[model samples]
Target chain A: MERERICFTLNNSPVEIHCHPGERLVDVLREQLDLTGTKEGCGQGECGACTVLLDGRAVNSCLVLIGQVAERSVLTIEGLAAGGKLDPLQTAFVTEGAVQCGYCTPGMIISAKALLMEKQNPTEAEIKEAIAGNLCRCTGYIKIIKAVQTAASARLEG
Target chain B: MQDQVVGSSPVKVDAKDKATGATKYPGDLRVPGMLYGKLLYSPSAHAKIIGIGLADAWQVPGVRAVLTANDVPGHNGHGVIIPHQPVMARDLVRSVNDVLVAVAAETMAAAEEALRKVKIELVELPAVFDATAAMAEGAPLVHPEGNILSHHKIRRGDMAEGWARAAAVVENTYRTQMVDHAFLQTEAALAEIDDGGILVLHVATQYPHWDRKELSRALGMPEDMIRVVGGSVGGAFGGREDMSLQVQAALLAMHTGRPVKIVCTREESFHAHSKRHAMVMHYRTGATGEGRLTAVEATIIGDTGAYASWGTNVLRKAAVHATGPYIVPNVKVDAYAVYTNNPFAGAMRGFGAAQPAVAYEGQMDEVARVLGLHPFAVRWQNAMTEGCITATGQVLESGVGLRATMEKAGSLVGWDVSKING
Candidate 1:
């Protein structure tokens, strides 16, 4: 097994790592860098529980190999908040009662953040389309859609 | 007093940590010198094990150990109510998902590679898939005790006289298929020998104490030599109630003197755990022209599959709730939990009530059509009120609010008055 050294920007920090080229990015992030926030729900790309921002686009980290992440910027759930203040999306989710069991919360928030970053005011259908990949069994999508709408409005007011 | 926190919405205690990806589940656990374990399952639904060859698997680089049923140092049986299911297949495998072998190695890839090297020889046996066919005289017996696991019955007033008073009758059969829980997180467990030589297991299970007892018995270790702990679960809709990887991981860890972790893939999770029972139900109901109920009869057959994992309780509940919430003076219900070589059936959200409710409610709709009465009107007329006796002979002292619930539902949906008159 050969280890290749690759440099990449992670959570606004530059880092270099030597690891297997075919290793899953989710494994590298969790096992090597201690970034266990990016979960691996299905280990396949079907479930979006391992969603991470790869150069401003949401991608399933489990499907991305370490070699593919070289020279790219990656963002995860840990990097969503700045200066100890919770992200508005995170707060809105709590206020709107969108989270239950909370296993899918991080991935859902990441997907929602990716949507909000691209569009200022997404329609209800657009919001639904954005999160169609992430599955939450408890909330039934009513409170989640409401929370996304609330976050978009709060962003506009701010 | 006005409720302060009872009705008010409060944020869940684990919401923040989970949102920030800080909460750790059992799958996220990792310990020093930990080995990954991979299990081999039976491919045939029913088979007799001839022998297992493990010399090639032992030769694989980084492979620590390969274990089979013979390696289980204690009692090999494990089940919620009945000690019938084997931890590993010894001589016979009644289901396709029965564990055959387990391999522990330094890495997951090594463990999987070693698993492919292990050879298993099995003689295929004639399998019985249908519940009714399984109970037939000539069908293959899933268990030596015959195919019928248990039967429940509920009888009320004279069925003949009640049917004689009815103006119309409706009879039909309904069937439901097995459903998987499909939770976000699959089954996962980590086992390690602690400082005091006690095997500590962290798993995603509904019952940690029961897991400890089962693992202790299977490993031939004293209860005090094992400690089971549960972490934050992702989602468990009664699917995590059964044992998955707890005992296997503990055995591997104890044999190799290192931590062992096993995480089931989504495909393995579907084959490994218990599922909701598939039911076939027959319902017959007699009602008057004025939409009053006279008699009700139901027969429910539940295919409990290979093992009796809470099947008897499910059959009992199905029999008790066969007549629905209506007040039927004359009723007879029969429910049977039959064994087959299909997937094992166990606990789910509604247990057994959901299946019979579909049948009884569907019969109500048919009865309404036969009497030319509105659906809501027929249900409202026959709905049980306070002090009405149930089919099981239990008197409802209070809290019989079916009529009120129907009225509210009808109002919310805006029932058409003109259609009812027509």
Candidate 2:
């Protein structure tokens, strides 16, 4: 198969790549772009492990074809921090012991951020709805819900 | 606040990497000159392989390697507990998802195309779908040994005497649905024979060390020859403990002399992966007129599916914990794991405890209702505490917090809410 040049902005930097037309976006970002923060839970869209901000909306990168993301902006969990500082949500998650197994954290953070971006003051019910699709088998959502509420309050107080 | 960590909650060690998309999941591996691999599944639930035609697949462009049952160099079978499942089907395909052939190609499309071109001829046979139906006389034999996988029984005291001494009795049945691990990440692996003639397999699994042993045995290769590195698992929930594509990819990579990557689609993930056992449980409990517990009896039927993954263990644990945290002096429990054509059932969260939580709690509610006693009052009268002996005769030496958990829930819900039975 012939390779094609694909252009996309990952995190905050513009990247140009040549890859097989059949390559998955998750693979292209991980192997070619070296953005491994986007985990692959299931190749299908069921698990949100490969979730990323595709044009500012949380989407599973594993389900999207590389060609589909040509010239689009992608923001992964790596992009959440600024200047070596943890994102407020990430900090809240860590402090509240929200992350267990950690497989669901990245997707959870991304989904939570998507929720916060849409609603500045989301109720506890709203936060649950946002991360409901991103399953965390270990923590059982008690601490995660607390973490989101904590982050929301932190944002509000600040 | 003296720099605590363990119970105080530290950020998950892998959280940053996982969140940032810096984790190298098995699916993210890409090797130079690597080929994609796809498995050819058996169409019939039970069949005898009369012939296999792979010439058409071999002729397909970009196809690098094709493998069958003849290719396994080791034990030819892989099962977590018993060696009943074939790495690749031999003379007979026991279930509908048996692997008949494996193909590796330069691209996934080519590999899938090659798989489609291959032909397999099978003689269909009778199949069984139910555990009890399979156990009856003249049922289709799933295994040469028999249809019944294992039976677990626990007896603590005389059931007839316990019932005779009781003033209130509650009998009920409960069932749990089949649940998948539903991990976001599907099964995937990248493997190849290195220059030193050793197999390097990069895969995602809960038990990496266990995979090293199981894969080595199934591949007919030395344990040292196979090296398994745990990848960034999206989520496992005990689903990735068994074999998936690691052996087949390694086999293809060894034969083709190139890196081989195999990624199962979501539908394939659903098909190849084992699920939580669908269980039907029958419980008969005896209680005092004032809601004090007397005795209990439980019989469980577990659908173990095709191969015994952890079904026996699941049944045993379920039988022992069938009485839950209740203080029952006399208890008798029997649990059975039987074979079926359904998807293989194995460990999931709650192990076997989750099944009885729903069942026994419902029974507790019914017992309270029959005696005109409050549910919480009834449970508080009989709930186990520290030093309580379980139905299996195992004493809870520590971490026996059932009474505290119930009390906390009670306080939080308040006294009036506790009496109301749902």
| Candidate number with greatest lDDT | 1
Q: List per-prediction Cα lDDT, in the order shown.
A: 0.88, 0.82
TM-score of chain A of each: 0.95, 0.93
Model 1 residue B323 lDDT score: 86
Writing each residue's lDDT as its tens digit, candidate 2 over B1-422 gives 44876666445676655445456778778878989999987787788899999999998899999899999988888778897777889899877557889999987889999989988989988888777788899999888889878989888878788998899998998888879887766789999878888889998888889888988887777889788888677678878878877789888988999999998877778767778888888999899898888888888888888889888888888887798888998998889988887778888887777887788889999998998988898888787887888887888888878777876888787765444434
Candidate 2 residues A51-143, lDDT tens each?
A: 888888888887788888888998888888866677778878877877666777888899998888888889988998888778776654998
What would the TM-scores of all predictions be? 0.96, 0.90
Q: Tens-digit lDDT track for model 1 on B1-422?
A: 34696778887777777778888888788888989998888888899999989999999999998999999999887889896888898999999668989889999889999989989899999999988788789899899889999989999999998899899999999999998887888888999999999999999889999999999989999999999989888888888888888888998998899999998988888877888889999888999888789999888999999998888998889899998888898999989999999978888888888889889889889998998888887877778888888898889999877877776777779986445534
True contacts kept of each: 0.60, 0.62
Each candidate's B-chain TM-score, in sequence, is 0.96, 0.95
lDDT of 1 at B207: 92
Q: Pick by TM-score: which candidate is best?
A: 1
